[model samples]
Target: MNELGLNFLDLGDSDKLPIILIHGMALDQTMWTPQIPVLKEHYRVLTYDIRGHGLSEVGDAQYTYKMFADDLKSLMDYLEMDQAVLCGLSMGRAIVLRAYDMYPHRIKAMILSDARSEADSNETKYWRENSIESIKKDGLENFADELVGNIFCQFQFQEASGSGGVNSKHRLIIFIRGISQPLSSSQMMHDKIVNSEFKIIPKAGHMSNLENLEEFNHNLLEFLGKIEF
Candidate 1:
């Protein structure tokens, strides 16, 4: 839709509620496929490939989160969607969080999964850049191996066989350090938004939604049910 040429999937009737699902880094709109069936039953669900992530065009200019947010607005305008429930995982959540600043009224609610809502620290930023270089120097498979290992072994939310639980910031660091960071490091966003929910899918990592789709969908349906009440 629009000149941006974002590849998107729209499901359900126009008369139903609207829900937009935004995916994280290294992921495409298909990441939300498991949730679409349940969501489309009651709402018109919109799933799009963000620029440079999937099939979307990658332009020369370096972009900011706000630019991504603007692209969302452009798409919304094209679709004549006034407001919708926004659900994002990791970096996807950050983009929508920025969108709230420019168009607060456009969001009906937010679902922030496996992401913080604060600005990135210099150390975290540096570490990610370093990790990217490592990925390039080493190999994509190795990088994936390390990432998945970290998630399964060192990054479990609840206490598990070999993993540790993160009740405080110290243990949480392992989970937070990644390719797709959150919006900020403080609860300021939760306070600012007023109508938001944080869902922690246990036994899962940064890719929590994908790792545990059953529980994820259960929680999601419950959340949406509440919104209707």
Candidate 2:
């Protein structure tokens, strides 16, 4: 893991083709743990924390999808990645969409998971505002604990509940630990989430990757496989 310019976790053989993985808001590179082993078997996997979320330096500028997209582009340029498949979840997906819109030639294909392109509904926006307030008031630690429980399906929750029922709890602990650091500026991210123009994954909430991992991964791999390398 390097945090010099952009905080990233580089895994697998560097000589292999590059694949960039972008995590959603309130999440860091660890979100790709499930996919890393599978992906690294075929390509060089690079997972990074977006600015303000992980070990990356929280810049003075407000967060925006365009800024996030620019960061990815800059990272790719810095690393000399000519073109690579960009896979993102939630906010990460928005970043990739903006990146494609800004620099289409730099991206070969994209995997958008559990994310939306359109702005959130008034209800959803209210929820986000409440969430932001909760995070600010009670801190991310407690908020993360409450947040992860709502991410999975009831069936999944039941299964987890049956097996000593701590997966979600454990995952939340890890997630909260990662994001417990101070935020740079969430105003841009908050605004973007509230007033996004595109909503790609209508069925998914925030944690679409985990809720529908199989389907999501299948769609992602299929898209990547179809791309002409």
Candidate 1 lDDT over residue span 1-229, tens digit each: 4486788888898877688889986568998989998889988999999886678877776767888899899888888899877787777877766776678677776566666755667986796687668877996678767766654423443444001111222111112122233324423444443344444455555676666677788877777665541
C-alpha lDDT values of all predictions = 0.67, 0.61
Candidate 2 lDDT: 0.61
TM-scores, all candidates, are 0.75, 0.72
> Candidate 1: where is the Cα deviation over 4 Å?
128-198
User: Candidate 2, which segments miss by more than 4 Å at Cα?
Assistant: 1-4, 161-208, 211-216
| lDDT tens digits by residue: candidate 2, 43-108 | 888888898887888878877778888889888877778887777765676677677778877776
RMSD of 1: 8.2
TM-score of 1: 0.75
